[model samples]
Target: MWMNEKIKASEVELTGLNGEDIGIVPTREALAMARKLKVDLVCTSLMSSPPPCRLVAAADAKKEAQAAKAKSSDRVVKVKEIRLTPNIEEHDLDTKKQQAARILQAGNAVMLVVRVQGKEGAAAKVLLEDLVRELKEWGRAKTGIQVSGKQAAVQIDPVA
Candidate 1:
């Protein structure tokens, strides 16, 4: 997004202040026009052959870009991780469950991982299954509890 004197293209496909296409014009000419209108010469698309440039107020363009970025960020789904131990106490489990519920309500996936030692491996799997059942109203298990060696994990996605 080159602006003003930073635009390197010798020619540009110009769009006027009112969004009217001004066809391809020399870069210097476009800059002159923008200067006359008291707007910045913004190079909108650098991939095109002539590079598309537009005449717009710098502040307005900045606000539009920020708005677009914010809108895009809102749709991004993140995976929230909650780690637990097989011998976790009842109170601690409840705390983790509440945390997971909050993450699910925010439209994110929660991955519950339980680490165990030797004989506690089986307990870890059972613990994850019970947790999933308790959180069923807020989120559904995306995958059944997966147990491998000393770890058990399950992914829960927000109920849509």
Candidate 2:
């Protein structure tokens, strides 16, 4: 964003501080107008025949950019994953369920993964069904149990 004396363009399409078009004018005259308004001549577009420049306070532009950055950063959502085995003990299952419930309550998505090995592979489907039933109160399953090799997985999102 070339501004003031740093702008080497001979002519520029100028816009007023209030965003009204001031048409194309010599760079020197634009700089003089910007100085009179107590604002900087910011080069906004360089692709036109004469680069487009706007009269604006640099501080205001920086503040607007910072506000936009903060607003964007606040909307991020996180996905949480919980891993389980087909033979998971009752107490362990309860603990995992609590963790998943907390994640769902916080408006995050949860991925339930059931790992099976050897003989347990045949029971993976049943284990996943029970897990989905137990977690029904917390969230609805977005993806039905999908088994791939040694693992079966389901994705659940918050109820509301």
Candidate 3:
């Protein structure tokens, strides 16, 4: 990204503002040419014998980089977790379902976890299966119900 006087090389393989090859030239001459065009002399590749340089407007490069950053940020996906118990009441389950639906509509994945304690361990698996079936319209299960210690969990992703 060395530009203008910041470039330490004495010579470079230059490309014009319009991307036309200008061949190898002294760094001072390249700087003068860039000055004439009101652009920057940026060192693009330093691996060659004569480092490759390009004449480009600094403002344009900055704008392009900002646009790319914004584009990448917009495509970020988040995973949201909703925890429940096997003996959760009907009203609470409905509330959780609504929250999961909202998260799915916003383009996020959901991890459903049913925490089991003592005698509740066996029934938690059945509860998780029923929960998956209930939410089938909003999302598809990415993983089958799995038991890890005292927790039964499944991951679901929003339907495309």
Candidate with top lDDT is 1
TM-score-wise, the better of 1 and 2 is: 1
lDDT for each residue of candidate 3 in 69-94, tens digit (9 for 90 to 100): 78877766688999999999999999
User: Candidate 1 clashing pairs?
Assistant: none
- Comparing 1 with 3 on lDDT, the higher-scoring candidate is 1
Error of 3 at 79 (Å): 0.9
Over 4 Å off in model 3, which ranges?
Answer: 1-74
Error of 2 at 59 (Å): 31
Error of 2 at 113 (Å): 0.8
RMSD to the true structure for each prediction, in A, is: 7.6, 7.9, 7.7
Whole-model lDDT, model 2: 0.84
Global lDDT for candidate 1? 0.91
Tens-place lDDT per residue, model 2, 12-90, is 9999988899999999999998888788888866788799888889797566557767888775557798999988899
Better of 1 and 3 by TM-score: 3
Per-residue C-alpha lDDT of model 1 across residues 1-101, encoded as one tens digit per residue? 57889999899999998899999999999999988988989887788889998999978878877877788777767999999999999999999999999
Count of backbone clashes, every candidate in sequence: 0, 0, 0
User: What do the candidate models score in CA lDDT, each in turn?
Assistant: 0.91, 0.84, 0.87
Evaluate model 3: give its lDDT. Answer: 0.87
The TM-score values for the models, in the order shown, are: 0.56, 0.53, 0.56
